[model samples]
Target chain A: MAEGSFQYITLAASLPHLGALFSNADLPMSRYRLEERLSMLEDEDRRRLDRIAHVTSWPGVDGCDTDAEVVARFEAASRSVQAHPDLAAVVRERLETRMLVAALRLRRDGAADPAPVAAWGRTAIARAIRTNWSEPTFGLGRARPWLRAARALCAAGDHIGLERAVLTEVYRQIDRAADDHQFDFEAVAFFVMRFQLIERWQRYDATRARGRLEALLQSTLAGAWTAGNATPTGAGMAGSLSQ
Target chain B: MTDLVLVLGWFGLFAPVALGAIGSSIGCARAGSAAIGAMLDTETGYGRFIGASLMPSSQVIYGIVIMFSLQRDPMTAEAAAGVFGVGVLAGVALLYVGIRQGEVLASAIVAAKAKPEIFGISLAPAAVLEGFAVFALVFALVLSGSIPG
Candidate 1:
């Protein structure tokens, strides 16, 4: 065969292999089933699977070649998965377990480094626990662990970790209040503002602080005006803070 | 008879001042309620805001003094009646202005609560109300002298 024709045939053959690999990797399955299937793949196919997994995993590649390049890669991977529907569960479960273990290891070793990466790990783990765990079974006694982990990361000057924890708690409180149909706008606003202020303080810069405050005021005013609520009386608890 | 006219004239001159006091009291109450509303979420530093709301009533007190001054003088029946009518008009105006001013003060308190940085801006409208009350009080003083023997 001519050199060009040989190259074409090789490429065409690889496409099917790639499709099989994508399907086997992207499919969702129980954590154990995923591990079992991954163990069964041939070495070369497993290597390809690893490359795709790393590409799609948390804190995925940044500063890509171009938007088109990124989209093409994602689309190809997705298309490959679509061609082999049976592998979906295994792919998903493997990714989830891998992420959970990586996050846990990072948390365990985070105390020594206390770097941004460690902070990210802590946050990821907290999120995983929340998503995978629920009330009465896994959630009841787990809050303290997450809080402790977050606090440790924060003490290490992990702004991202602190922010993640603060935001998560704030959202949890908001959700709870919403579910209960209790309107505590003032309390919510106050706590949220305090969290924002703390974040600003951690990332200390005078100009940025002023800008944030100005933006907060503008947003607050806009929110009130849009809601058609009573304009806040200047005499309220937040009066001093406003000043 | 002149003494009686003077006494009546004094009463007329003071009537508006009394009306103003009533108005101020109402205004103060409304302003207090608004301040309370603003302070509900954050209970600190409410005392100062409450004090500011009470500031407008000083003019009402002044109107009362003018009316008392007229009572001490002697005047004719015609002068007394004229002064009395003016006093009534001034009192009615003071009352109306006071209540409206209270509303403005309430708004100011709310503003202060929300934006302590801009609380000063809220004071302007309340000041305007105070200005009108002062104007009414001045009118009462002027009319007090017109009471008959």
Candidate 2:
């Protein structure tokens, strides 16, 4: 639908509430069903939404062979979502967030400076990160408060904590955009983005992790199952990975 | 001036019904769309949603009543003034209330769908809007009695 013609009361109302982040263990609706509902959108709108998703979701950039390719795809996606101001803001924040988190990870991994990380982020932040390489928040802590806590999480060797903090910040950004819209394309786009986050969170469930481990075990261990498998494994890889 | 007053008399005579219809239609359509959308997500309680969507229709009913109360057997300059004042003002009130009522009802429906327990309390705002429309209707009828027929 056109921007102003988006009377999506029915469309938005049809979708169930996604509640707070990490509040629900499972998605209110499945990806397939959500896609079916979203098919009601015009082709142009759907394409715009896809572009927005490409910038924010991991799978959107999964096929890129190099960082430059990813950056190029991100630029294109950012342009496509410009028509939606709220969503444009969301895309912008997501990019900055990804840059900030990546910088954190690289620094944690013993990168000496932000010079290499500067190649992929915005111009404004490239200078800040590069100049503040020795600073804990890279001198943008006040502007980006989440970065301070995120930096602390990285230093404390809490990768899972860092992941949680990053996801929460991203979720809040989308949630803020969502508050301005109720029955429009922006609402749908925000809903889909939040759904992706919820799905990712659910995938971090212990049951799902156990299932994945079993599948891997069946392949590598040749389906071997000892009776001791029923006993406590003392916090296996699945335990730490479960959200 | 007399002819203009007579023309306004006719305009005022029909204003309530016409304006009310406009308001009701807008309100009903807004809430009705929300109700339909809510139905897709829900299995039961369709009746309540449909019923809530009809809340805006009362604006038209009040408009019709105002029209009847403002009716004069033979339009005159003196009666024309009161008719125009009461009927037009009443119509404007209904129109505004109807549109606002629709918006609130739509919000109520959406909120209630998320939390069903709030459905009853959610209608409170729309009900209060109905009270305002009734106030316009009641006073217009009272004032219509004083017009020089």
Candidate 3:
């Protein structure tokens, strides 16, 4: 009967169900529609949702210069959303999942030992990764069944597969949290998080990225040749550089 | 003492209607909000959602019936206790069932919006709750017959 509960129920009901990850290539709802529904959230809850999104979403962390900086942002964001324990756990779980993937990547890159727990700031997951660095799944295959597939994908250098597997796991995590919340702030957060994954996955186009990369390489080579030929005019190489 | 008893008798006579109305209002509000929200997400079936939300409104009508059933010739201390017990308890049942029905109906509306095929079946739980409200109503009516006029 409280005002906030009514608003949450409305917001929740307005959101169309996002089916299982990869079930739909297109998003169930548009960003504009989602933001409009989200407008009903209380100011404080809205702030928390923003913080959580910034810490977890790709666009939110685009400016971070280092892994440690990303972890610091996650910590702050997670702390801000502490009022919702499920969402808070979600933030932590996301950070740990990413850290685990990073660990797997490190192993694939020929690292002799696991990265220190300080960088990842997930002591439990980090320690597991450290102790089971030689193990294919980092000894977490039981709980996180996707770990084995993720490790295999990392080993095979299947960036796309790894991305899909990791996103699927993250999506599953958000989905699990959603089971406990229907018409509350936590439910809204879970909905937004899952929507983000769906949007991100739909946006992913490996072929387009590869094409763009090749075009950039050609342009850079052409710029280098032009700079080399400009020697007749006594132009400095640095000056002739296209960048 | 007799005056207090007479006042209680009158309070009992109207309690079912008052309490049931409160419950129905809250239940209908909860379900109706969900229905309105679902309407924003779907293209059709607005009527079904609205109908589902009205399911809780039956509580108020049941309350009214109980009010009529518990009506006696005149307010008397002898029958005050019996009427109070039956009227208040029935009202409480209606109130509780009404609110719970609203919660379930809201959930049902939201779910049925997602998978339209389940709309009819999703209402089973709410129907069960309506059965509970009827139980309270029928029993209150049957019990009212035994109260001394």
Candidate 4:
């Protein structure tokens, strides 16, 4: 695309704002602390992030407190990006992987059947979307191998390893997508996503990484009572490269 | 007839200036945006940023030199044609190089902002574009000597 074209300009303008959206979700920091950190960014950067956040946030969804609600929030965000099919696919893939891992964790902890894990919402439907028959084998199948890795990590009680595996996988796809489509708008989006991912990953204190892993496992073990906790703090593998 | 030769000679004399100026303006402007964006991310290193942005400005200087070299007291039709051909082609070449070089500089600025240590390395591509512009300038200057005055 020409540099000054609408699509190119829009993609360029949207890139800096992604800093906030994809920032490592593995941290347990408070929203206020996140806001304080954001305040230090350039005015243009701050404004763009705020504007995108405002647009994407649902009207009545005040603080998603359950796995179902969190999934809903992700779905809403994914739909918001539907104007760009490649981005929508990338985002949807990320959400699906998270859902898969969370379900596997629930199954490992107590739940015998994974089908009704989120009866309050259409978790089954979301799963179906992720495992659709029409998609590429290696692309969608990549998540399955990661799912197996997550299960193995859970079996071994390797919380840190699980976090590292899942997050790295999520960004692996994004980074690959970016590299594969170097000249497209999706490449810019992928680069920005990867940037945000790295920012968040770096910000997490390496020394306290184990404690964070314990926190994640503890919340997972708490079952439905603690499922909502994962929503705020986020649950995933991060900083695998750091280790 | 004499007036036409003078007119053609004047056009040849100024062609590089017009084309090179357009290129420099566009290139510098493009690079300036990236430099300005990067300066916001760092407090120091403003000097390097400014220096990078001015990379395209050299095209205009080349244009000016070519304009002066093309000037002659008794300009002939053949000489005027030679002047117009060399000056205009060189100007056009410089114009393209300047704009492309600016884009390269802009990308370098973006990358350097992300990782400050890559500042020097990021300039490599822009230097190559500048080399192409230099090649055009040198050839124009050398060829001007052969044109009948």
TM-score of model 3 vs. true structure: 0.88
Interface RMSD of 1: 35.0
Fraction of native contacts under 8 Å reproduced by each candidate: 0.00, 0.62, 0.59, 0.00
| Better candidate by DockQ, 1 or 4 | 4
Residue A84 local lDDT, model 3: 74
Q: Please give the DockQ score of every candidate, comma-separated.
A: 0.00, 0.57, 0.59, 0.18
Q: List TM-scores of chain B, every candidate.
A: 0.82, 0.98, 0.98, 0.93
Looking at model 2, residue B14 earns an lDDT score of 95
Clashing pairs in 3: none
Docking class of 4: incorrect
* Whole-model Cα lDDT of every candidate shown, in order: 0.51, 0.84, 0.86, 0.65
- Candidate achieving higher lDDT, 3 or 4: 3
Docking class of 2: medium
Q: Mind giving the per-residue lDDT tens digits that candidate 1 earns over A144-228? A: 3445555455447676565555445433443343232111222222222233333333344445678778877776666655554
Error of 4 at B31 (Å): 2.8
Candidate 3 residues lying further than 4 Å off, grouped into runs, are A1-4, A206-243
Q: State the fnat of model 1.
A: 0.00
Between 1 and 2, whose lDDT is larger?
2
Q: Which ten residues in a row have the lowest lDDT in candidate 3 chain B?
A: B73-82
How do the residues B4-72 of candidate 1 rate in per-residue lDDT, one tens digit apiece?
Answer: 766767677777778788878877876776555455434476786788678658657866776665564
**Clashes by residue pair, model 2:** none
Chain A TM-score of prediction number 3: 0.81
C-alpha TM-score for every candidate: 0.36, 0.87, 0.88, 0.60
For model 3, how does the per-residue alpha-carbon lDDT over A168-204 read when each residue is reduced to its tens digit? 9999888888897888888888888888888877777
lDDT of 2 by residue, B1-149 (tens): 99999999989999999999999999998888889988888888899998999999999999988888888888888899889988899999999999999889988998999899999999999999999999999999899989989
